[model samples]
Target: MPKQPDPARRSERSRQAILDATRELVSEVGYAKVSIEAIAARAGVGKQTIYRWWRSKGAVVFDSFLALSDAGEGDLALPDTGDIEADLKAVMRATVAEFADPAFSAPIRALNMEIIGDPGLAAQYLEKLAGPLDEAKKARLRSAQQAGQIAPDADLDLALELLYAPLYQRWLLRSGPLTPEYADALVDLTLKALRPSARP
Candidate 1:
């Protein structure tokens, strides 16, 4: 008879399976309807298996959240094309496409509604999702400063906000179509708005 799989490998497989199941269900049904029992059944594991690792359905949904946002496979890196306008357009263009992907938007919207209702989940999302993206924005702004494209003394944090906040508002609020043209408009507007203040 074949020997039983080792515990560590078994655990890792189970974890991946659970995460995958959560992603599939949340994509199709939104986070509102996905349950621990459904996830357990989809993953071919016991409900206890899920409960043993995650304290709540929200937590599992959160992991799946990351998976889908980050290309559902791995890192969602923003490119560094060295030219601020070109680079920002490249990144934001890709981000816009990803946002509109049928596979990604619904689950994220469900998560957003959850955040609206629960302050705790909002804080959790800020920590897990928003924080890193914020840092990356700052890093991109700093790069622009170094390239002499932005004022050397610019408040990079604010600069990052100016660059990202509008696009984010458009996406989260559905205020406009997140088209490539829209993203390019943002790139132009950002560079123009941040153009070095005139010296007296």
Candidate 2:
């Protein structure tokens, strides 16, 4: 008799297949046009399999994006180097590179537009995607504050906005190029603003 496959392995394979199918479909057809049926057919899985793991088409697409980011370079993590500025610049540069990738840009732009138009979807996106990244950055900022790299009273939330908003705005509006140099500049400006005051 043939040996049976491991259930956990089979489950992971199905999950990865669904995510891969979603990513390819989103890139080809855009997020709004991709459906659960299409993903199920593409992944060679039943519709029930997709529904078993994800609540909706949007959730699957978000997970696909997350998987892509993780496969690319574990995008959810921020460096915890003692040099806070260097750590932040590293993260920003990676973000700029991802934003510039055509495969990522198109689908992410579609998702952003979708979230903007739907409050419920926007909340979901924030919770699943942006919220984790925000928490990671805030944790890094708190670490820096404890180390005296940043002012103790600095608002980490606002600091995060200052660090990321310029690059995001440029990507969203096509107002300027999203480049490593731009990312570095943003990091420098933010660090300057957050740096602890010099003792007289």
Candidate 3:
């Protein structure tokens, strides 16, 4: 008798295939045009398989984007070197690089445009994409506070916004270049604000 395939491996393969299909289709046809049926066909898996794993097209696409990030270089984890400024600068620089990358930039821009036109979709996008990144930054800020790098009473949510708002404005408005120097400047300014005041 022929050897049977491992159920776990088969499931993993199916999951990866679905994600890969989603990415390719989204890149080719844009997120608004991609559908579960098309993704299932491209993945060569039954439609029920995708529905079993993801509740909607947006959820599938979100997972696909995450998988792409994982395959490329893992998630956007902030570096913790104990030097808050240096760590923030490193992450911001990486963010600039991702924004400069065509593969990442184009799809993200498409999603941003979609969100601007649809309030409901905007909320979903924020929950799926921005929410995790914001939480991670807040956690890092809290760690810095504990280390005395940041003010004990700093509002972490506002502090996080200060770190990235300029970059976001530039990207959204297409008003200026998002260079590494710009990212460094944003980090420098944010660190100056967040750092505990020196004793007189």
Q: For candidate 2, lDDT tens digit of each residue in 4-32? A: 66877798899999998998887777766
The regions of model 1 sitting more than 4 angstroms off are: 1-16, 24-38, 46-59, 71-77, 198-200
C-alpha lDDT of residue 117 in model 2: 88
RMSD (Å) of each candidate, 1 decimal:
4.4, 3.1, 3.3
Give the per-residue lDDT of model 1 (tens digit) for 26-132. Answer: 76786667899999999999999999988888777776677665544555446678888888888778878877775667667767777788898788778766766
- Candidate 3: segments with Cα more than 4 A from true spot: 1-5, 70-76
TM-score of 2: 0.86
- Mark the 10 consecutive residues where model 1 has the least summed lDDT: 68-77
- Candidate structures ordered by TM-score, highest first: 2, 3, 1
2 or 3, which is superior by lDDT? 2
Q: How many clashes show up per model?
A: 0, 0, 0
- TM-score of every model? 0.74, 0.86, 0.86
What lDDT score goes with residue 48 in model 3?
A: 100
For candidate 1, give the lDDT of residue 91: 79
lDDT of 3 by residue, 70-144 (tens): 323445557789888888888889887777677877776776777789898778877876777788778888888
| Stronger candidate by TM-score (1 vs 3) | 3
What lDDT does candidate 1 reach at residue 42? 94
